[model samples]
Target: MLRCSHVLCKVDDIAAVVRDYRDLGFTVEWGSAPGRAHNALLWFGSGPFIEFFELPPVFGLLRHPFGLVHGGPAGERLARWARPGEGWRDLALETDDTDLARARSALRTAGLPVSRVIRGRRTRPDGARVRYQYLASRPAGLPFVVSAYDPPQRPARVVHANGARAVARVRMGVAPADRARYAALVGEDRWLSAVPAATTGVLDVELEGLSGPLDPRKLHGALLAAAREERG
Candidate 1:
């Protein structure tokens, strides 16, 4: 089954952003740490999760080619100007691939671009050895990242806060050109109207009645508080 796994958020402050999700009542799950080289997942009940992937300290938002490719920063022009949170970063889908072959074919048949599969074993702080398969690529500059759950690695189900449910409609604000390409590539007609709003340079994830609109400012405050509580 195809499910929206996580919404990737490229942020300047990982802790702060993470806390925000927790404050909003979502159960926050931290991934392999060391901050810079890792990411965190905020479970939104069942399958849908929101992840915060940090940019290496040595590099700014736009410094990496991958970031730039997905509407992030590029070169040394200072990506901070592009704003802290923006763009329809990436969409991750979950698949159970025992052989890891059939999962690849589905993406090909759908004409979605595919990237090399990365294999690695991650040790959780609790001493759980989790193995994962990461497949990602930009289909026409629109990212389609797929991940298969390896049972022996970690539990397939993630538990978030109670009453945390993903509403049917989630608005992804994007540039007209990019938005059109995304709709065509994903093969979904989620875009309500063809009319594009002014360029905020930041991708806004609009939740129907959850919390109106989400941005870095509100997120930062909430995440910081959660981290402090978690640390204490």
Candidate 2:
């Protein structure tokens, strides 16, 4: 089965996001590059991570045919998925060759629109290369089927001021008709529930361990919170 890979959060400015997340007491790893990276990430040493990215007008790139060649069908879908404004825009599901084969077969067996292998790679600030591939299917709400990273990037530090250890769960929201399918594919839990919502996407994200609330105003109404862990 597929697992929650990462939640894509779109921001107007990458620098502000890195700074804000850092201020929130979480280690933010620059995704694109050190000085001019378009994205940054928050890793808690385990589980899924949160990716913050910016999609500013790329000098008339998307409007040109060469851009389409560069991004391909999957890339076009990603660009279209990320609408204007801030907050959680998209979600991804991690899969290995086994899981990908299973998911690929399942989609074909069910007559779903399956995509060709789409690969992408990026360079880190330190000059290390990060690469991965995935498949996209019909229906905009479906998460991308991403492959496991060979050598996943690590943050300079995983330590956080808050007691947040890892992603407790992601409270996902989907169309009522699509909830069951989503639940079946991604599973349901306190954090990763595919509940019914008017809008289809991530409803909120809950990080494990914390007693107080974060300022929603600063978060741009992204609906992220930290709850005290329930010990049995």
* Top candidate, metric TM-score: 2
lDDT of 2 by residue, 1-232 (tens): 5778888887888898777767777667888676879888888777788888887645225533633553344555555545568988778888755236667677567665656666677888788888877777545566667877756665545877766777887877788766555655566433466667876678788887753566665675467777435332
lDDT (tens digit, per residue) of candidate 1 on 71-103: 221222223323345324554555665343566
Backbone clash total, candidate 1 = 9
Supply the TM-score for candidate 2.
Answer: 0.82
What local distance difference test score does each model get? 0.47, 0.69
TM-score between model 1 and native:
0.59
Please estimate how well model 1 matches the true structure, expressed as its whole-model Cα lDDT: 0.47
Model 1: how far residue 91 lies from native, Å: 1.4
TM of each candidate vs. truth: 0.59, 0.82
Best by lDDT: 2
What's the true lDDT of residue 162 in model 2? 65
